[model samples]
Target chain A: MGVIGVVATMKVQAGKEAEFEKVFKDLQSKVKANEPGCLQYDLCKSKSNPQTFVIMEQYESQEALDAHGKSDYFKAAFPALGAVLDGAPGLEFLDRID
Target chain B: MGVIGVVATMKVQAGKEAEFEKVFKDLQSKVKANEPGCLQYDLCKSKSNPQTFVIMEQYESQEALDAHGKSDYFKAAFPALGAVLDGAPGLEFLDRID
Candidate 1:
């Protein structure tokens, strides 16, 4: 009902860290510039594992979150991002308690 | 070396959500008010599983994060919070890629 937070845990292919990050950063910038409802969109690398990365995102509402997935840039970037991924990313939706 | 984020994934005991939230909220407030380097401290509940909760936190540096764990308030609240946990929490440290 309120802000929605999405934690996307992903494992990059052993040697594709650079490719994965480049594609993701492009997507990140597009999301931030075009989606006003998207509050926080940042990429993070796990301190312990070079291959593990997480995308921490916050959206203003359900519609905004939905818009993100359906955006043209997101759709265009999906394949590139997936290509470098070790496997499917783990997605967990969280409802902000504030 | 830069801003750090910690994702704490915890499972609260069934029916202990209220107690867990209460203790966590108290700790959250203290962390927000007293810790100057704590940029974000939020508690979130998973949409799919009520028992699953995550604390999304950001610190200016690793030192700030270390201080959070050693704070007297954090020390006092740990036991109360642990009592309501389903199991040990999973902690992931992240280096912000920005």
Candidate 2:
């Protein structure tokens, strides 16, 4: 049973785009090293809104995602990331409906 | 069976962001009218590069996607879109691996 997934959209503070991207980019190596279930992790920025970004993650299952949430990198960097974010992130967990 | 889908990235010319978006916004009404197969159609731009955009489309299957490709709006607008694009867009079609 494969679960279809989606990109999670997060918004950064007005002047914190560079800081946010740097933090996210740094987490890349850590996330890749530890999260075995993460098939793909990509970061995308909004062309229209410089403060908005989309993070796309592909995982095997909810279990893997839960693990990812609990990882050290997630714990260590989330606070810094959260402080610079303007609002809550948007999550779209999708399933095929056809 | 349902098909897993991904977003397609498209880049606009250096100074044609507004024109591209205007054209895209116009296609919005047309796309919605004809492509019922399009479960979702979203447009996003890169925060780092306003000229870069990503169009995410979700469809039931390849047949439905084929229909979208042949739509009247696609035919009319793609040519205009092509002329302003700097390079080919990026595409990521995904499926669960676990």
Candidate 3:
């Protein structure tokens, strides 16, 4: 109910790295521009496994997260994410404790 | 190696969460106090699973990580972390891309 944190891992297919990042950059920019309730949404590339990417996101509330999911930008971009990813993403939902 | 980001997950042994967080708090404070190269160190608890904890840490470079691992505080606290955790922590090393 408080601020929600998300740490999700998506592994791009072997040869689709460029395309994955390109789509992600657009999603990142749109999220930043359109979602005020999205406090921070950082995109990271794994150092251990270069094909893997991690998204660290913060939302003001659960409602905000729902809103984000229902947004036009999210709808437009999510399919593109799934297309380039190797398999299902690994997601962990978190809350600030300290 | 430019800037290293780490997302580590630890699930405390049943009935030992209180102890785990206490040790973690101490470690967090010490890292902030002593590690100049650590730009950010955030502690988060799982919303989906309360016993799980996530630590998001940032270091200036690989060398800084080596220094962190070698610090007296790290040496002292890491064993405590292992003792309270249900299993070995899950660590994912990352680099900022956006």
Worst 10 contiguous positions by lDDT, candidate 1 chain B: B1-10
Note the B-chain TM-score for every model. 0.98, 0.86, 0.94
lDDT (Cα, 0-100) at B56 in candidate 1: 89
For model 3, the DockQ equals 0.77
Which pairs, if any, clash in model 3?
A: none
Clashes of each: 0, 5, 0
- Cα lDDT of model 3 by residue, B54-90, tens digit: 9878789888888988999999998988998998899
Candidate 2 per-residue C-alpha lDDT over B20-65 given as tens digits, one digit per residue, 9 for 90 to 100: 8778877866878877777666665654556767665666676877
Per-model TM against the reference: 0.99, 0.51, 0.91
- Best-performing candidate as measured by TM-score: 1
Q: Which ten residues in a row have the lowest lDDT in candidate 2 chain A?
A: A89-98
- Compared with the true structure, what per-residue lDDT tens digits does model 2 show for residues A1-98? 35434567788998998898889888877888888888667676654566777776666777887888888888899899999999888765543111
**lDDT, residue B43, model 1:** 93
Clashing pairs in 2: A46-B45, A46-B46, A46-B47, A47-B45, A47-B46
RMSD of each: 0.6, 13.1, 1.7
- Residue-wise C-alpha lDDT for candidate 3, range A1-98, written one tens digit per residue: 57788898899999999999999999889999989999878888987888999988878888888898898988999999899999999988888765
* Cα-based lDDT for every prediction: 0.94, 0.70, 0.87
With candidate 1 superimposed using the best TM-score fit, by how many Å does residue B66's alpha carbon deviate from the native?
0.7
TM-score of chain A of each: 0.98, 0.88, 0.94
Per-residue lDDT tens digits for candidate 1, residues A6-59, read 999999999999999899999998998999999999899999999999888899
lDDT accuracy of residue A3 in candidate 1: 94
